[model samples]
Target: MSERVTPSAEAARALRDIERRRGQARAADQESRWVGVVFGVAIFAELAAPDFFGDGVRSWIGLAVAVLGCVYVVMLRTPRGGALLGRPTRLRKDELSPRFVWLARLAILAVMLIGPFGLRFLPQAPFPYTRTVVGAVLGATLIIFGRTLQRALTSLALRRDDKDGLGGATYGSR
Candidate 1:
Protein backbone atom coordinates (compact mmCIF):
# COMPACT_ATOMS: atom_id res chain seq x y z
CA MET A 1 0.00 0.00 0.00
CA SER A 2 1.17 3.50 -0.83
CA GLU A 3 1.18 6.12 1.88
CA ARG A 4 -0.41 9.46 1.23
CA VAL A 5 -0.37 12.67 3.18
CA THR A 6 -3.26 15.10 3.33
CA PRO A 7 -3.18 18.60 4.77
CA SER A 8 -4.96 19.18 8.08
CA ALA A 9 -7.90 21.61 8.22
CA GLU A 10 -5.75 24.25 9.82
CA ALA A 11 -3.06 23.71 7.22
CA ALA A 12 -5.62 24.01 4.46
CA ARG A 13 -6.93 27.22 5.93
CA ALA A 14 -3.45 28.65 6.15
CA LEU A 15 -2.83 27.70 2.57
CA ARG A 16 -5.98 29.48 1.55
CA ASP A 17 -4.89 32.56 3.41
CA ILE A 18 -1.51 32.44 1.71
CA GLU A 19 -3.14 32.13 -1.67
CA ARG A 20 -5.36 35.10 -0.94
CA ARG A 21 -2.45 37.15 0.28
CA ARG A 22 -0.42 36.17 -2.77
CA GLY A 23 -3.18 37.26 -5.07
CA GLN A 24 -3.48 40.55 -3.29
CA ALA A 25 0.27 41.00 -3.39
CA ARG A 26 0.30 40.29 -7.09
CA ALA A 27 -2.40 42.87 -7.70
CA ALA A 28 -0.58 45.36 -5.53
CA ASP A 29 2.64 44.63 -7.39
CA GLN A 30 1.01 45.27 -10.74
CA GLU A 31 -0.58 48.46 -9.49
CA SER A 32 2.73 49.60 -8.09
CA ARG A 33 4.41 48.94 -11.41
CA TRP A 34 1.80 51.01 -13.23
CA VAL A 35 2.32 53.83 -10.79
CA GLY A 36 6.03 53.73 -11.49
CA VAL A 37 5.41 53.90 -15.21
CA VAL A 38 3.00 56.79 -14.77
CA PHE A 39 5.49 58.56 -12.55
CA GLY A 40 8.17 58.13 -15.19
CA VAL A 41 5.92 59.44 -17.92
CA ALA A 42 5.02 62.44 -15.80
CA ILE A 43 8.66 63.20 -15.13
CA PHE A 44 9.46 62.85 -18.78
CA ALA A 45 6.63 65.15 -19.74
CA GLU A 46 7.60 67.80 -17.24
CA LEU A 47 11.16 67.79 -18.49
CA ALA A 48 10.59 67.23 -22.22
CA ALA A 49 7.69 69.57 -22.84
CA PRO A 50 8.49 72.60 -25.02
CA ASP A 51 9.10 75.17 -22.31
CA PHE A 52 10.10 72.95 -19.44
CA PHE A 53 7.02 73.10 -17.19
CA GLY A 54 5.80 76.55 -18.04
CA ASP A 55 2.29 78.00 -18.38
CA GLY A 56 2.00 77.17 -22.09
CA VAL A 57 -0.70 74.88 -23.45
CA ARG A 58 1.68 71.93 -23.74
CA SER A 59 2.70 72.39 -20.15
CA TRP A 60 -0.90 72.53 -19.04
CA ILE A 61 -1.63 69.34 -20.91
CA GLY A 62 1.36 67.67 -19.38
CA LEU A 63 0.30 68.73 -15.92
CA ALA A 64 -3.20 67.43 -16.51
CA VAL A 65 -1.89 64.08 -17.61
CA ALA A 66 0.40 63.89 -14.62
CA VAL A 67 -2.41 64.81 -12.27
CA LEU A 68 -4.60 62.09 -13.69
CA GLY A 69 -1.76 59.61 -13.26
CA CYS A 70 -1.39 60.70 -9.67
CA VAL A 71 -5.07 60.15 -9.09
CA TYR A 72 -4.86 56.67 -10.50
CA VAL A 73 -1.88 55.94 -8.30
CA VAL A 74 -3.76 57.02 -5.23
CA MET A 75 -6.73 54.89 -6.22
CA LEU A 76 -4.47 51.84 -6.23
CA ARG A 77 -4.14 51.89 -2.48
CA THR A 78 -5.55 48.77 -0.82
CA PRO A 79 -6.50 48.10 2.79
CA ARG A 80 -2.99 46.74 3.35
CA GLY A 81 -1.18 49.43 1.40
CA GLY A 82 2.06 50.91 2.67
CA ALA A 83 4.40 53.73 1.73
CA LEU A 84 1.96 56.03 0.02
CA LEU A 85 4.46 57.79 -2.24
CA GLY A 86 6.81 54.89 -2.77
CA ARG A 87 6.41 51.14 -2.28
CA PRO A 88 2.68 51.15 -2.97
CA THR A 89 2.18 47.79 -1.28
CA ARG A 90 1.99 46.11 2.11
CA LEU A 91 5.21 45.62 4.04
CA ARG A 92 7.36 42.63 3.15
CA LYS A 93 9.97 40.87 5.23
CA ASP A 94 12.65 40.26 2.61
CA GLU A 95 11.94 43.27 0.45
CA LEU A 96 10.71 46.85 0.77
CA SER A 97 12.13 47.37 4.21
CA PRO A 98 10.98 50.51 6.00
CA ARG A 99 14.42 52.06 5.63
CA PHE A 100 14.42 51.30 1.93
CA VAL A 101 10.97 52.82 1.61
CA TRP A 102 12.12 56.03 3.23
CA LEU A 103 15.21 56.05 1.06
CA ALA A 104 13.15 55.64 -2.09
CA ARG A 105 10.90 58.52 -1.02
CA LEU A 106 13.88 60.71 -0.22
CA ALA A 107 15.51 59.95 -3.53
CA ILE A 108 12.34 60.82 -5.42
CA LEU A 109 11.90 63.97 -3.38
CA ALA A 110 15.48 64.98 -4.08
CA VAL A 111 14.97 64.58 -7.80
CA MET A 112 11.77 66.57 -7.66
CA LEU A 113 13.42 69.35 -5.69
CA ILE A 114 16.72 69.47 -7.52
CA GLY A 115 15.90 68.72 -11.15
CA PRO A 116 14.32 72.03 -12.06
CA PHE A 117 17.00 74.08 -10.37
CA GLY A 118 19.69 72.05 -12.06
CA LEU A 119 18.04 72.62 -15.42
CA ARG A 120 17.77 76.34 -14.81
CA PHE A 121 21.44 76.59 -13.92
CA LEU A 122 22.52 74.66 -16.95
CA PRO A 123 23.78 76.78 -19.87
CA GLN A 124 21.04 77.12 -22.46
CA ALA A 125 22.16 74.90 -25.26
CA PRO A 126 20.65 74.92 -28.79
CA PHE A 127 16.95 74.05 -28.91
CA PRO A 128 16.98 70.51 -30.33
CA TYR A 129 20.00 69.55 -28.30
CA THR A 130 18.52 71.03 -25.15
CA ARG A 131 15.40 68.97 -25.63
CA THR A 132 17.44 65.88 -26.26
CA VAL A 133 19.49 66.46 -23.13
CA VAL A 134 16.49 66.86 -20.88
CA GLY A 135 14.76 63.89 -22.43
CA ALA A 136 17.78 61.69 -21.97
CA VAL A 137 18.27 62.66 -18.34
CA LEU A 138 14.65 62.24 -17.34
CA GLY A 139 14.11 59.14 -19.47
CA ALA A 140 17.18 57.49 -18.04
CA THR A 141 16.09 58.32 -14.55
CA LEU A 142 12.66 56.89 -15.26
CA ILE A 143 14.01 53.66 -16.63
CA ILE A 144 16.32 53.23 -13.67
CA PHE A 145 13.61 53.86 -11.12
CA GLY A 146 11.07 51.75 -12.96
CA ARG A 147 13.44 48.81 -12.98
CA THR A 148 14.14 49.29 -9.31
CA LEU A 149 10.45 49.32 -8.46
CA GLN A 150 9.81 46.22 -10.51
CA ARG A 151 12.66 44.39 -8.84
CA ALA A 152 11.41 45.28 -5.40
CA LEU A 153 7.95 44.00 -6.19
CA THR A 154 9.27 40.85 -7.77
CA SER A 155 11.50 40.17 -4.82
CA LEU A 156 8.71 40.65 -2.37
CA ALA A 157 6.36 38.37 -4.24
CA LEU A 158 8.95 35.67 -4.62
CA ARG A 159 9.86 35.81 -0.97
CA ARG A 160 6.24 35.54 0.04
CA ASP A 161 5.70 32.63 -2.28
CA ASP A 162 8.67 30.87 -0.75
CA LYS A 163 7.49 31.46 2.77
CA ASP A 164 4.07 30.06 2.00
CA GLY A 165 5.49 26.91 0.33
CA LEU A 166 3.98 27.98 -2.94
CA GLY A 167 5.19 25.58 -5.62
CA GLY A 168 6.16 27.76 -8.55
CA ALA A 169 8.81 30.39 -9.04
CA THR A 170 7.38 33.57 -10.51
CA TYR A 171 8.88 36.44 -12.48
CA GLY A 172 12.13 34.50 -12.90
CA SER A 173 12.81 34.12 -9.24
CA ARG A 174 15.89 32.11 -8.36
Candidate 2:
Protein backbone atom coordinates (compact mmCIF):
# COMPACT_ATOMS: atom_id res chain seq x y z
CA MET A 1 0.00 0.00 0.00
CA SER A 2 1.25 3.51 -0.89
CA GLU A 3 0.20 6.87 0.48
CA ARG A 4 -1.26 9.43 -1.86
CA VAL A 5 0.71 12.62 -2.54
CA THR A 6 -1.13 15.91 -3.08
CA PRO A 7 -0.43 18.02 -6.14
CA SER A 8 1.01 20.87 -4.04
CA ALA A 9 3.30 18.42 -2.22
CA GLU A 10 4.55 17.02 -5.53
CA ALA A 11 5.13 20.49 -6.90
CA ALA A 12 7.09 21.49 -3.80
CA ARG A 13 9.20 18.34 -4.06
CA ALA A 14 9.95 19.04 -7.70
CA LEU A 15 10.99 22.59 -6.90
CA ARG A 16 13.25 21.31 -4.14
CA ASP A 17 14.86 18.88 -6.57
CA ILE A 18 15.43 21.65 -9.06
CA GLU A 19 17.07 23.77 -6.38
CA ARG A 20 19.34 20.89 -5.38
CA ARG A 21 20.47 20.34 -8.94
CA ARG A 22 21.07 24.05 -9.44
CA GLY A 23 23.23 24.10 -6.30
CA GLN A 24 25.30 21.21 -7.60
CA ALA A 25 25.74 22.95 -10.94
CA ARG A 26 26.96 26.08 -9.20
CA ALA A 27 29.50 24.10 -7.18
CA ALA A 28 30.72 22.39 -10.34
CA ASP A 29 31.07 25.75 -12.05
CA GLN A 30 33.23 27.07 -9.19
CA GLU A 31 35.38 23.95 -9.23
CA SER A 32 35.98 24.32 -12.97
CA ARG A 33 37.73 27.67 -12.65
CA TRP A 34 41.04 25.82 -12.45
CA VAL A 35 40.27 24.11 -15.74
CA GLY A 36 40.33 27.47 -17.47
CA VAL A 37 43.78 28.15 -16.06
CA VAL A 38 45.07 24.75 -17.18
CA PHE A 39 43.81 25.20 -20.75
CA GLY A 40 44.96 28.81 -20.77
CA VAL A 41 48.48 27.77 -19.92
CA ALA A 42 48.34 25.02 -22.52
CA ILE A 43 47.17 27.47 -25.19
CA PHE A 44 49.92 29.93 -24.26
CA ALA A 45 52.54 27.20 -24.46
CA GLU A 46 51.32 25.93 -27.83
CA LEU A 47 51.37 29.39 -29.37
CA ALA A 48 54.55 30.66 -27.70
CA ALA A 49 56.63 27.56 -28.50
CA PRO A 50 57.44 28.71 -32.02
CA ASP A 51 59.01 31.93 -30.79
CA PHE A 52 61.48 30.03 -28.59
CA PHE A 53 62.09 26.80 -30.54
CA GLY A 54 62.94 25.65 -34.07
CA ASP A 55 60.15 24.45 -36.42
CA GLY A 56 60.76 20.75 -35.68
CA VAL A 57 60.91 21.29 -31.94
CA ARG A 58 57.88 23.54 -32.09
CA SER A 59 55.86 20.82 -33.83
CA TRP A 60 56.89 18.24 -31.26
CA ILE A 61 56.07 20.58 -28.40
CA GLY A 62 52.72 21.44 -29.92
CA LEU A 63 51.96 17.73 -30.41
CA ALA A 64 52.87 16.93 -26.82
CA VAL A 65 50.78 19.80 -25.46
CA ALA A 66 47.83 18.81 -27.64
CA VAL A 67 48.08 15.17 -26.54
CA LEU A 68 48.23 16.21 -22.90
CA GLY A 69 45.21 18.46 -23.31
CA CYS A 70 43.28 15.65 -25.02
CA VAL A 71 44.23 13.19 -22.30
CA TYR A 72 43.16 15.61 -19.60
CA VAL A 73 39.84 16.09 -21.37
CA VAL A 74 39.30 12.32 -21.68
CA MET A 75 40.26 11.84 -18.05
CA LEU A 76 37.73 14.47 -17.01
CA ARG A 77 34.95 12.19 -18.25
CA THR A 78 35.91 9.37 -15.87
CA PRO A 79 34.52 8.97 -12.36
CA ARG A 80 37.81 9.68 -10.64
CA GLY A 81 38.39 12.65 -12.92
CA GLY A 82 34.93 13.97 -12.14
CA ALA A 83 35.80 13.76 -8.45
CA LEU A 84 39.04 15.58 -9.09
CA LEU A 85 38.07 18.05 -11.79
CA GLY A 86 34.33 18.57 -11.27
CA ARG A 87 31.94 17.40 -14.00
CA PRO A 88 30.32 20.09 -16.07
CA THR A 89 26.52 20.27 -16.08
CA ARG A 90 24.23 21.81 -18.66
CA LEU A 91 21.45 24.22 -17.76
CA ARG A 92 17.92 23.10 -18.51
CA LYS A 93 16.46 24.48 -21.76
CA ASP A 94 13.98 26.56 -19.81
CA GLU A 95 16.81 28.10 -17.84
CA LEU A 96 18.48 29.70 -20.83
CA SER A 97 17.34 31.91 -23.66
CA PRO A 98 17.83 30.14 -27.00
CA ARG A 99 18.59 33.32 -28.86
CA PHE A 100 21.30 34.39 -26.41
CA VAL A 101 22.79 30.90 -26.41
CA TRP A 102 22.97 30.77 -30.21
CA LEU A 103 24.51 34.20 -30.36
CA ALA A 104 27.20 33.22 -27.89
CA ARG A 105 27.98 30.04 -29.81
CA LEU A 106 28.30 31.96 -33.07
CA ALA A 107 30.58 34.55 -31.47
CA ILE A 108 32.86 31.83 -30.10
CA LEU A 109 33.00 30.13 -33.49
CA ALA A 110 33.90 33.37 -35.23
CA VAL A 111 36.71 34.05 -32.78
CA MET A 112 38.06 30.51 -33.16
CA LEU A 113 38.16 30.81 -36.95
CA ILE A 114 39.56 34.33 -37.20
CA GLY A 115 41.75 34.97 -34.13
CA PRO A 116 45.03 33.26 -35.12
CA PHE A 117 45.00 34.25 -38.77
CA GLY A 118 43.90 37.78 -37.93
CA LEU A 119 46.78 38.18 -35.48
CA ARG A 120 49.31 37.05 -38.09
CA PHE A 121 48.30 39.79 -40.48
CA LEU A 122 48.89 42.63 -38.02
CA PRO A 123 51.83 45.02 -38.58
CA GLN A 124 55.06 43.31 -37.49
CA ALA A 125 56.70 46.39 -36.01
CA PRO A 126 53.85 47.15 -33.59
CA PHE A 127 53.15 43.50 -32.78
CA PRO A 128 56.48 41.72 -33.09
CA TYR A 129 55.36 38.94 -30.74
CA THR A 130 51.97 38.53 -32.32
CA ARG A 131 51.46 34.86 -31.47
CA THR A 132 52.82 35.30 -27.97
CA VAL A 133 50.75 38.43 -27.44
CA VAL A 134 47.57 36.77 -28.64
CA GLY A 135 48.27 33.64 -26.62
CA ALA A 136 48.96 35.60 -23.46
CA VAL A 137 45.89 37.77 -23.91
CA LEU A 138 43.69 34.74 -24.52
CA GLY A 139 45.25 32.80 -21.66
CA ALA A 140 44.84 35.70 -19.26
CA THR A 141 41.27 36.20 -20.36
CA LEU A 142 40.45 32.55 -19.66
CA ILE A 143 42.16 32.50 -16.29
CA ILE A 144 40.78 35.81 -15.10
CA PHE A 145 37.34 36.03 -16.71
CA GLY A 146 36.33 32.38 -16.39
CA ARG A 147 34.87 32.73 -12.94
CA THR A 148 33.19 36.02 -13.78
CA LEU A 149 31.55 34.55 -16.86
CA GLN A 150 30.37 31.55 -14.90
CA ARG A 151 28.77 33.82 -12.33
CA ALA A 152 27.02 35.80 -15.05
CA LEU A 153 25.63 32.65 -16.67
CA THR A 154 24.57 31.28 -13.31
CA SER A 155 22.77 34.53 -12.58
CA LEU A 156 21.05 34.35 -15.94
CA ALA A 157 19.84 30.84 -15.18
CA LEU A 158 18.65 31.84 -11.74
CA ARG A 159 16.73 34.76 -13.21
CA ARG A 160 14.95 32.31 -15.50
CA ASP A 161 14.15 30.11 -12.56
CA ASP A 162 12.63 33.10 -10.76
CA LYS A 163 10.62 34.00 -13.82
CA ASP A 164 9.25 30.46 -13.86
CA GLY A 165 7.84 31.06 -10.33
CA LEU A 166 10.68 29.60 -8.30
CA GLY A 167 11.83 32.14 -5.75
CA GLY A 168 15.15 33.74 -6.67
CA ALA A 169 18.12 32.06 -5.01
CA THR A 170 21.49 33.69 -4.74
CA TYR A 171 24.71 31.80 -5.34
CA GLY A 172 26.03 32.71 -1.90
CA SER A 173 22.83 31.61 -0.21
CA ARG A 174 22.93 28.28 -1.98
Candidate 3:
Protein backbone atom coordinates (compact mmCIF):
# COMPACT_ATOMS: atom_id res chain seq x y z
CA MET A 1 0.00 0.00 0.00
CA SER A 2 1.22 3.57 -0.78
CA GLU A 3 0.99 6.44 1.60
CA ARG A 4 -1.00 9.52 0.55
CA VAL A 5 0.30 13.00 1.34
CA THR A 6 -2.09 15.64 2.70
CA PRO A 7 -2.41 19.07 1.07
CA SER A 8 -1.10 20.72 4.24
CA ALA A 9 1.96 18.47 4.19
CA GLU A 10 2.68 19.34 0.57
CA ALA A 11 2.34 23.04 1.28
CA ALA A 12 4.66 22.77 4.25
CA ARG A 13 7.22 20.99 2.13
CA ALA A 14 7.03 23.71 -0.53
CA LEU A 15 7.49 26.45 2.05
CA ARG A 16 10.53 24.73 3.45
CA ASP A 17 11.95 24.31 -0.04
CA ILE A 18 11.39 27.95 -0.80
CA GLU A 19 13.13 29.01 2.40
CA ARG A 20 16.06 26.78 1.62
CA ARG A 21 16.40 28.24 -1.86
CA ARG A 22 16.25 31.77 -0.46
CA GLY A 23 19.03 30.92 1.96
CA GLN A 24 21.14 29.60 -0.89
CA ALA A 25 20.54 32.70 -2.96
CA ARG A 26 21.54 34.89 -0.06
CA ALA A 27 24.74 32.92 0.39
CA ALA A 28 25.55 33.30 -3.29
CA ASP A 29 24.98 37.03 -3.08
CA GLN A 30 27.34 37.27 -0.15
CA GLU A 31 29.97 35.29 -2.00
CA SER A 32 29.73 37.70 -4.92
CA ARG A 33 31.27 40.43 -2.79
CA TRP A 34 34.59 39.44 -4.28
CA VAL A 35 33.35 40.55 -7.69
CA GLY A 36 33.26 44.15 -6.53
CA VAL A 37 36.73 43.93 -5.08
CA VAL A 38 38.12 42.46 -8.26
CA PHE A 39 36.50 45.12 -10.38
CA GLY A 40 37.73 47.87 -8.07
CA VAL A 41 41.29 46.64 -8.29
CA ALA A 42 41.03 46.44 -12.06
CA ILE A 43 39.80 50.01 -12.24
CA PHE A 44 42.61 51.16 -9.96
CA ALA A 45 45.19 49.37 -12.02
CA GLU A 46 43.87 50.73 -15.30
CA LEU A 47 43.87 54.30 -14.07
CA ALA A 48 47.12 54.12 -12.14
CA ALA A 49 49.04 52.34 -14.88
CA PRO A 50 50.34 55.55 -16.38
CA ASP A 51 51.81 56.57 -13.04
CA PHE A 52 53.88 53.41 -12.68
CA PHE A 53 54.51 52.21 -16.22
CA GLY A 54 56.03 53.48 -19.45
CA ASP A 55 53.76 54.18 -22.44
CA GLY A 56 54.39 50.77 -24.02
CA VAL A 57 53.72 48.87 -20.82
CA ARG A 58 50.68 51.02 -19.96
CA SER A 59 49.14 50.23 -23.32
CA TRP A 60 49.64 46.53 -22.73
CA ILE A 61 48.06 46.82 -19.33
CA GLY A 62 45.11 48.65 -20.82
CA LEU A 63 44.72 45.97 -23.44
CA ALA A 64 44.84 43.26 -20.82
CA VAL A 65 42.21 44.99 -18.69
CA ALA A 66 39.97 45.44 -21.72
CA VAL A 67 40.31 41.83 -22.72
CA LEU A 68 39.64 40.61 -19.20
CA GLY A 69 36.58 42.82 -18.97
CA CYS A 70 35.26 41.39 -22.20
CA VAL A 71 35.87 37.87 -21.00
CA TYR A 72 34.08 38.54 -17.75
CA VAL A 73 31.09 39.93 -19.65
CA VAL A 74 30.96 36.96 -21.96
CA MET A 75 31.21 34.59 -19.03
CA LEU A 76 28.37 36.37 -17.28
CA ARG A 77 26.07 35.12 -20.01
CA THR A 78 26.86 31.47 -19.43
CA PRO A 79 25.45 29.23 -16.70
CA ARG A 80 28.81 27.88 -15.59
CA GLY A 81 30.32 31.33 -15.62
CA GLY A 82 27.45 32.79 -13.68
CA ALA A 83 27.78 30.06 -11.07
CA LEU A 84 31.50 30.60 -10.88
CA LEU A 85 30.97 34.31 -10.40
CA GLY A 86 28.25 33.77 -7.80
CA ARG A 87 25.72 35.72 -9.83
CA PRO A 88 22.52 34.82 -11.60
CA THR A 89 22.80 34.42 -15.34
CA ARG A 90 19.42 35.96 -15.80
CA LEU A 91 17.32 38.31 -13.73
CA ARG A 92 13.55 38.53 -13.97
CA LYS A 93 12.05 41.95 -14.72
CA ASP A 94 10.02 41.84 -11.54
CA GLU A 95 13.19 41.45 -9.49
CA LEU A 96 14.36 44.98 -10.30
CA SER A 97 12.40 48.20 -10.35
CA PRO A 98 13.04 50.20 -13.50
CA ARG A 99 13.04 53.51 -11.70
CA PHE A 100 15.66 52.41 -9.26
CA VAL A 101 17.71 50.94 -12.08
CA TRP A 102 17.66 54.18 -14.00
CA LEU A 103 18.52 56.15 -10.90
CA ALA A 104 21.49 53.97 -10.22
CA ARG A 105 22.74 54.30 -13.77
CA LEU A 106 22.40 58.06 -13.74
CA ALA A 107 24.18 58.30 -10.42
CA ILE A 108 27.08 56.24 -11.73
CA LEU A 109 27.31 58.30 -14.86
CA ALA A 110 27.32 61.56 -12.92
CA VAL A 111 30.08 60.32 -10.70
CA MET A 112 32.17 59.17 -13.65
CA LEU A 113 31.82 62.47 -15.41
CA ILE A 114 32.16 64.67 -12.38
CA GLY A 115 35.21 63.05 -10.88
CA PRO A 116 37.75 63.81 -13.61
CA PHE A 117 36.19 67.14 -14.53
CA GLY A 118 36.23 68.29 -10.92
CA LEU A 119 39.78 67.13 -10.51
CA ARG A 120 40.82 69.15 -13.56
CA PHE A 121 39.90 72.41 -11.85
CA LEU A 122 41.85 71.78 -8.69
CA PRO A 123 45.29 73.37 -8.20
CA GLN A 124 48.15 71.11 -9.24
CA ALA A 125 49.50 69.03 -6.38
CA PRO A 126 53.30 68.63 -5.82
CA PHE A 127 53.18 65.37 -7.75
CA PRO A 128 51.13 64.67 -10.88
CA TYR A 129 48.96 62.19 -9.01
CA THR A 130 45.56 63.18 -10.41
CA ARG A 131 44.91 59.86 -12.10
CA THR A 132 46.14 57.95 -9.10
CA VAL A 133 43.92 59.91 -6.71
CA VAL A 134 40.91 59.63 -8.96
CA GLY A 135 41.49 55.96 -9.52
CA ALA A 136 41.80 55.18 -5.84
CA VAL A 137 38.65 57.12 -4.98
CA LEU A 138 36.61 55.63 -7.78
CA GLY A 139 37.87 52.14 -7.10
CA ALA A 140 37.06 52.37 -3.40
CA THR A 141 33.66 53.82 -4.19
CA LEU A 142 32.91 50.94 -6.52
CA ILE A 143 33.88 48.33 -3.95
CA ILE A 144 31.80 49.92 -1.20
CA PHE A 145 28.76 50.86 -3.25
CA GLY A 146 28.72 47.68 -5.28
CA ARG A 147 28.19 45.56 -2.18
CA THR A 148 25.51 47.89 -0.87
CA LEU A 149 23.73 47.94 -4.21
CA GLN A 150 23.86 44.17 -4.50
CA ARG A 151 22.31 43.78 -1.09
CA ALA A 152 19.57 46.25 -1.91
CA LEU A 153 18.83 44.49 -5.18
CA THR A 154 18.73 41.14 -3.43
CA SER A 155 16.30 42.49 -0.88
CA LEU A 156 14.13 43.88 -3.61
CA ALA A 157 14.16 40.57 -5.42
CA LEU A 158 13.22 38.66 -2.29
CA ARG A 159 10.42 41.09 -1.52
CA ARG A 160 9.12 40.76 -5.04
CA ASP A 161 9.19 36.99 -4.76
CA ASP A 162 7.18 37.09 -1.57
CA LYS A 163 4.72 39.54 -3.02
CA ASP A 164 4.23 37.38 -6.10
CA GLY A 165 3.59 34.32 -3.97
CA LEU A 166 6.67 32.59 -5.36
CA GLY A 167 8.73 32.69 -2.15
CA GLY A 168 11.98 32.78 -4.22
CA ALA A 169 11.68 29.07 -5.07
CA THR A 170 10.72 29.93 -8.64
CA TYR A 171 13.63 32.33 -9.04
CA GLY A 172 15.62 31.78 -12.27
CA SER A 173 13.16 29.08 -13.32
CA ARG A 174 11.88 31.13 -16.18
Best by TM-score: 3
lDDT by residue for model 3 over 27-145, one digit each (tens)?
55543777788889988988888777845667787898889889888877677778778766355556566666777799899999998898899876556866788889989998989
Candidate 2, 1-174: lDDT as tens digits: 999999999999998897886666666645466788987898888777777674566778778887987878776556566556655443445556666777779989999989778868975636556678888998899899977877776665443426744332322221
Tens-digit per-residue lDDT, 13-99, candidate 1: 888986886665555444345455666666666556765554375758666876876666555453333344334454333443456
Q: Report lDDT per candidate.
A: 0.58, 0.69, 0.72
lDDT of 2: 0.69
Each model's backbone clash number: 0, 0, 0
Residue 102 Cα positional deviation in candidate 3, in Å, after optimal superposition: 2.1
Which candidate number would show the highest lDDT if scored against the true structure? 3
**Which residue segments of model 1 deviate by more than 4 Å?**
1-28, 31-46, 51-55, 78-95, 126-129, 136-149, 153-174
Off by over 4 Å in 3: 1-16, 29-37, 54-60, 88-90, 123-149, 156-161, 167-174
What TM-score do all the candidates reach, one by one?
0.49, 0.61, 0.64
Q: Which scores higher on lDDT, 1 or 3?
A: 3
Ranking by TM-score: 3, 2, 1
